[model samples]
Target: MASRSSSAAAIGRAARSSGLPRRNRRRVRRLCNMAGPDLMKTKLYSVSPPVKAKATNASLSGPTRYSPGMSTSRGRASRHKKTFPVPPAPREFQQARSRATYERILAAALELYAEQGFHATQTPDIAERAGMSVGGLYRYFRDKHQIFRELVHRGLEQNRQAQDRMLAAAEAGLVAGETDLHRAIEGVVDWTWKALHPTPPDLLRTLAAMAYLDPAFAELTEQYDRYERKALSRLLAKLTSRKRVPSPLAAARLLDLVVPNVGIWTALHPDEARGVKEATVEMIYRYLADPPE
Candidate 1:
């Protein structure tokens, strides 16, 4: 009995050594009891090295290493961004004073330009007349040409405003059943003659010369001419029927030519200025009243 027990125990030990399950080891024991220890002795076994589990750390998986020069997410965004300069706002008083200075400069330049003529006038002369340093004058206007351009622009603007007011008054008068061509011609001629009377012949000649010489002045003169023509056309349309004068544009052009020459003739010959104006009014009225064959 002791010997049989020892044999079964040896078989179970061998099965366990072979990496068999507990149930399989029991079955092997049973089989060993039946088949004896001879099978167990025939099996060969070898030992394997034990594997150690790696140690897990929460801090090791937490974050990457931070270098000295490395920036944070927000800092990195700001580092590559560009900044721009903002201009200071102009004050109201400063702007007003600037405008006053500009007007004063322009007035002085016009006087100098009128006295010395545009081509003969110098920047130093303009600055002295303006009662400002050359540098101060330059702050308002770049050069003599620029000053002349401004003067021309101012004169043109004034003339345009005057013409517009006159046209409006004429339009109002026409709407109120006033249709006397002779009276209208007299009023227009007198107004234009007076406007041109203040302007010196030298200044007028200088302006005319610039209109021919300078491209800038030529463009300005053309613009003023177009404006005047349009205003005249409006006035003519009110006075005459479309059937009688098919194109007011043509009539306006002819009238424009007559008026300026009259103004120039009157300006040159002040002694006969009134007679020239009355004759101009009569001639223009007659031309409009009786169309040429």
Candidate 2:
């Protein structure tokens, strides 16, 4: 009994010294009292393992050390979180979708640029007009400049195609001997007037402004001018056998200016469009038939 009391007393002292709470100390004392001396020693030793004091100075003097294969919160988050790659769409579907998106973005950009001017227009405005997000717009165009380039190029291509078709029709008419000088002259004037006036005045004004500021636009304009001049020269060659003007090339150039001018005049004076068209056709036919001194 005395030996058991001694053991219980020792455990109580040890528990208190080890910073155990008073309640825990009393519990340990009761447990120790219930056991034999040898059992009490084993139970006490098993319950109270030796606790090494933490090296506080190690933390104060150096950087925190983590065990090998351990990761920090940031590192763990990065390791577990991944960005999955986007799978590519099927070839045909991808191509069709791309072409459709390209056209939509181009059309939207053209309308916005025409309305707002190139410098004043933004990508978001274009995307919204096209019914897409800004990021979706970027999938087709790298920037607004790219969109502008594509829009100008697309317009130039459409103009080229229209001119080609008109030239082909004129060539066919000439070969068939179905178009006389009067009809040919009238056709040329009517076509030129329609082409120039089809585009809105504000859109033409925007293009003119852009041509001044952008070298690409200027170059495109020059290319189109060259093409028109060439086509007009070809048409004139087929129409006139005699050199009615000082130079056929000069005549073509002059007619180009005169045709567009008549179109602009008609636009400014819509009520006089018929009179202007007839008068302009007469002037061009007379000039082709008889050269001015």
Candidate 3:
């Protein structure tokens, strides 16, 4: 108990030094205490598809470095190049009732995180929003950060699934020799643009803030960023008439990272949105169409 209290206090101090407001400091402290001191001392790795472990902060000395699928997290155990040695046991709920409650908490947290801002929203707020008590909420997640991480993971997975479907259609069209590669590229960009349309600016800002403030969150975003870029690269590889672009990844990066981010802001102005999309689409298609020396 003494050690745990000390760990929580240390985290609280870190939170304060990190410029978190009073309310959020309390929330951070509570979360640390709930997870216990061992949570900080533990070094994390990807366990399986859904379950993951925590990254070490052993002395709260530095930011946690996150490793996504098949990447090295920290030290190399051996020259075997194996990651996730000794897979960690799963943590997700197995029971139907628990699963329902768990989802309810995530659903409520998703709304509250955007509506109230992640820092401003407390665990109690999430519980209340989910029609549960603080104690019940604790049963599922140790802290709000855990909930945020889960939300991001699930969102990224959903996006990858969507991309898979889109790619499948494009590939099927290619097999039939009916796919206009340029048109398929435009469709992909348009799909990405529309996906961002309904999300309020507040949520986007919230995501940006989280990524800025938390190393783990930043790493989580980067993992998906890598995936999306690769997915874009795969699209171009299928084009038989494609020129020999010196760097295919560069082209992929522009479409995956640049277009959608810039396009989202253009959407803020409803009248100009259509024009901006057309201009951006043309820019992306042209960039991919021609190879740079």
Q: Report the number of the highest-TM-score candidate.
A: 3
Model 1 segments beyond 4 Å from truth? Answer: 1-97, 290-293
| Residue-wise C-alpha lDDT for candidate 2, range 95-117, written one tens digit per residue | 77788888888888878876877
By lDDT, the candidates rank as 1, 2, 3
TM-score, model 1 to reference? 0.64
Clashes in model 1: which pairs? none
Q: Candidate 2: misplaced stretches above 4 Å?
A: 1-95, 291-293
**Two-way TM-score contest, 1 vs 2, winner:** 1
| Whole-model lDDT values for every prediction | 0.69, 0.68, 0.68
Q: TM-score of every model?
A: 0.64, 0.61, 0.66
Residue 264's lDDT within candidate 2 is 73
Best-fitting candidate, scored by lDDT: 1
Compute the lDDT of residue 58 as modeled in candidate 1: 14
Q: How well does candidate 3 score on lDDT at residue 271?
A: 74
Error of 1 at 7 (Å): 99
Report the lDDT tens digits of candidate 3 across residue range 96-210: 8998998899999989977878878888999999999999998888777677767776776777778778878887888898887577777787778766777767777788676
